[model samples]
Structure formats: structure tokens, C-alpha cells
Target: MSRLLDEEGLPPGMLAPLDEDPGPARRLSRQKSAALVQAAVLAALDAPSPPPRSRRRHEWLMGGALLVVGAAAVATWHLSRRSDSLAPVETPVVAVPAVVEPVRPEPVVPAVDSERAEVAGVMRTGAEAGGDVERAEVAGVGVMRTGAEVGVARAEPDVAGVGMKQTTTGGTEVGVPRTTPDVAVPSPSAKLRGTEMLPSAPAPEDLLRRANGHRATGQWKAAEALYLRVIRTDPQAMSAYVARVASGSLRLEHLGDARGALRQYQEAQRGWPGGVLEEEASHGVTEALRALGDRDGEARALESFLARHPDSPHGVAARTRLREISGR
Candidate 1:
């Protein structure tokens, strides 16, 4: 083979062929095997051996390993999904209802009657002002007289700054003064202007405004305080005193103060003797006294006031009330 190989020489390529040649079948010659037991291997040459496992076994092992890994991944995914499905549900956040504080509505103070309104205007003009101490004392004494029995009428001052005897109209009435004398009075509009637009005093509307504001704003204590201050400053403060009387009288179930306020109205009647307000005060006294469980006293006052002031605007109303009281 060496001689035959020498005859063919070598092939033409970048790499020179080895001196030994491995044919298509990697087999040794007879002399190279049994006969070649004694043969010498000049160059060490080797051929690859067959695989240890069969091809079918290798394919089955790879396929089984892939199937196991796929099954494990699918099992893990399924377990995770099951865990998620069974997980506790999240509760929706329910916004707690905002605790709304209730807004208390303001109190309703009755509109000051026009008669009281006019008297309030006169009072604002400082009608018959006295020393503060004397005015306060007079007001206090009037309040104290309610619980006491009827006694001698206290001495009061006439509008002329002179002391006058307080008479109780014991005889035929001398009649009420509703209209001023024609010579002393201005025109209708002028008289109204004189009464309403007092340049020398604060407007009665201003006092009414304050009283209404205090009452409407649910400020009972504040309203009471303002009423008291106004009545004290001007003892003839008709609307303010009347408003206080009304306010005090309304709480009759809780505060039985109508009698005290009724006495105050009586004092105001004396302080401002000759206006439509006097009749109104008398009526207010009648109503308040009746509320105080003294219907008889109320009836007598109403009769006296009505008998004295037949032409008063409220005269008809007073008569109606008297009739009702008499029937009762």
C-alpha cells in the first residue's frame, strides 16, 4: 500500500496529505489486524466509535425531558391562577358620609307695628329725657309693681316737665288725643316727614333694623340685651320695649315673664301719654295680662283704654278683644 501510495504521489491542495490514508471504510488490513498483530503502527490514527445509546432511546429521553419541563411549567401556572382566584376580594372604599352640621335658622322677630314704629321715632328724638339714674329707677319700679296689689297711683311727670298726679280715669273718660291741633301740625306729608325723618334723632328704622337683625340671627340673648339697652336709653322706646315684651311673652311655657313685660308696657304708656302708641301699649298690656292668667285685670284695662280712646286705630280691635274676653 505504501508502494501503491508512492506511485499515485500526493494530491494538489493547500494542505499536504498525510502519509497514511483512511479509506471510506475505516478498516484495517488483514496484516493490520490478526496478521497485523505483528504489524507496526507508524502513525497514531483513530476513528470515532458508535454512540453508547440507541438513536430511539436518545430521542425518547429528550422528548420525555421536554414533556416533563412543559408539564411542570403548566402546573406552576395553573397553581398561581388558582391561588389568585381564591384570594380574598378587595372591598371598595366607601367614602363615609360627611357629617353635616345642621345650620340653625335665624329667629323670626315680628315686624314692629306702625303705631309702635311712630312712637319709637318720637323716642329717638329724646322725648322728655330725664336723668339716666332717674329713668332707670322709674323703669325698674314699673317692673317691680306687677306682683304687688293695686295701690295708690304713683306720681308721674307730665310732658311739660312738671310733676303730675297719676289718675286712673275713675270717672267718665276725658277721651284720647289722636291728632295734634291743626295750628301746631304741618301738612299730612309734612307731619309724616316730621315723624319719620327726624333730623335731631336716629331713625326709628335704625332701631327696628338692629332689633330685627339680632332676633333673626338666632341671637335670643343678644336680641334681649339690645331691646333692654334701647328701652333704657329712651324710656319711651315703644317698638323695642314692645318687641321685648313679645319675645318674653312667647316663651310663656318656659318663662312666665309676660306679667313683668306687661308692667313695663304700662310704664311706657304713662311716659308717652298721648300718642297712638298709648292705646297700643294698653292693648299689649291687656294681652300680656291675659297671658299671665289675669283675665279680669286685662278686661278692665281694655275697657278703660277703649272707653278713653274711642277714635284710636286699634279701638275696634280692642273692643273685639274685650267682647271675646267678656264672653269667655
Candidate 2:
């Protein structure tokens, strides 16, 4: 009865029939749900909450990392600076050694042409003899000579090539007295048999006079040769400078030989370096090179002339030529 009252005590019709009392299964399900709830509550209460994140500790960690990065960057900068300090410095100036030139010895002068002077004197006498110089014997200096003794004979061409006429017979080649027969001329040594019997050496003045006379007489070849002879015999002679310049002029003006003119001027320079005619010689060299189509040679010659004779008479001309060559 007690069990009935405890559980099934309530009859369906008893007290308005307690609505369908749950069966044992239903009771068991309720007990199980309550136990699950109790367990969930216990678990919720027992689990330790995650420790609150420490803001100070986070800041410390971030600061440490930043410090390490900063240290690495500073060390890199310091190493770069050290490397730069250890590097070699560049200098603006590069030093080069100076060069020394070798010294050259002075040139020796050439010997004088005494023999040429003697021959010129003889030729002068022959010209004076009206081309009637037959043969001559050399006596002592200032001594007398025979009238028949001649060195050379003067002949005039005959009409229609008939026969030649000698000048010794008073302007007539026909038979005349004092006209000597043509014969083998005596050797120069034979003529000078007597000790220095040849007339006194002709002065430089005399040679220059004869040369001038030849030039005036339209004897261009003879005049040029005579002038050259005077120069060769004695470059230091009073008129040698004039003779050299004149010779070069004749070659250029009359002979049309620029090369020959060039040589004449060069000889003057060689005979008398830094002399009065050096400027002229330099000018001549330039002109000759130009004639030969050697532009480089002409330029060099002009430059050398200017360097040596800056104040020379030809200086202006030389400078002009240099400008032309250099396209200034």
C-alpha cells in the first residue's frame, strides 16, 4: 500500500487523476538530464580561466625585439663607416717625372776655296784680253808678261758657217798681224810654273763686280755661276751674303729651279747659321717645299723660321703661312 501511495498510489480516477504520472523510464530520463546539468556546471566552475594577458610583458617583449633590430642596424652602419675610413683616398694630382733633352755639339766650319779664287782671277784676265788669250807663263808676282802669251782666244762666227774669225785681229778675222794660231792651251799648272807667279788673288769685291757685269750683259748662266763661286770660295767674305741671296734669286727668277734655289738658301744657312740671311733661307725652304707639294714640310719649315727669327723681316710672312697651314 505504501509503495502504491508513493508511486502508483494515485489512481486514474482518484483526485482528478494526476495527469498521467511519468513512468519509470520518464523518471530515469529526468534524473539523467539533471546529472548532466550538474556535471556541466561543475566543469564550468572548475576550469581555470586563461591568465589575463599582461600588457607590460607584451611591451617588454616587443621592446626587446626592437632593441635587437636597432642594434643590428647600428652595427651595419658602423661597419660601413669603418670600411669607408679604411679605403684609399683619391688624389687630384698625378705626378709625372720630367724629361731631359740631350745636348748637341757645335758644327765645324768648312774649308775655304783658295783654288777657286786663283781660277777666277785667270778667267778674269782672259775676258779682258779680248778673247785673244793664247797661252801664258806665270812669272813671279807683279812681274811682266810677254804680249804673245794668252790664256784663251775669242772667236766670232763666220757668215754662212764659212769660217770663224778671231777677235785679236782688230775686229776682223781675216789675216791680220798679232793674231796667234790656235793651239793646245797650256795646263793651269804649266801656267803657274813660276812660284805663285799668278797675279795677286782677286778681291771679293772684284768677283762681285764681274758677276754683276755678267748679269747685266744678259749672260744669266755665267752670272749665276760666278755668284755661286764667290759664295763657295769664302762664305765669310764681305759680299758672300749678298752673293748667296743673289744666287738663290737667280735660280728662282731666271732658272725656274725652285729646288736649286732652295739649296742655295740652305747652303747660306749652313755656312752661316743664325746669320743675317737665315730668315731668307727659312723662307726659301718653305717656298721650295710648297712647290714640291709637301704641305707638312712647308709647315715645319715655316714654324722653325718663326721660332728662330721672330723679329725677322720674313716673320710676318712666316706667321701667315703657319696660319694657313694650321687652318687658324
**What are the root-mean-square deviations of the candidates from the true structure over C-alphas?**
52.2, 60.7
lDDT score at residue 101, model 2, on the 0-100 scale:
11
Full-model lDDT for every candidate: 0.42, 0.49
lDDT tens readout by residue for model 1, 68-115: 665665555555557657763532212111111111111111122343
Runs of candidate 2 with Cα error greater than 4 angstroms are 1-197, 214-219, 235-241
In candidate 1, how many clashes are counted?
Answer: 2
Which is the leading candidate under TM-score? 2
Candidate 2 RMSD to the real structure: 60.7
Assess candidate 2 and give its TM-score to the true structure.
Answer: 0.37
lDDT of 2 by residue, 257-297 (tens): 77777776676676678765566666777776776678888
Worst 10 residues of 1 by lDDT: 168-177
Which pairs clash (backbone N, Cα, C closer than 3 Å) in model 1?
A: 31-36, 32-36
TM-score of each: 0.32, 0.37
Collision count for each candidate, in order? 2, 7
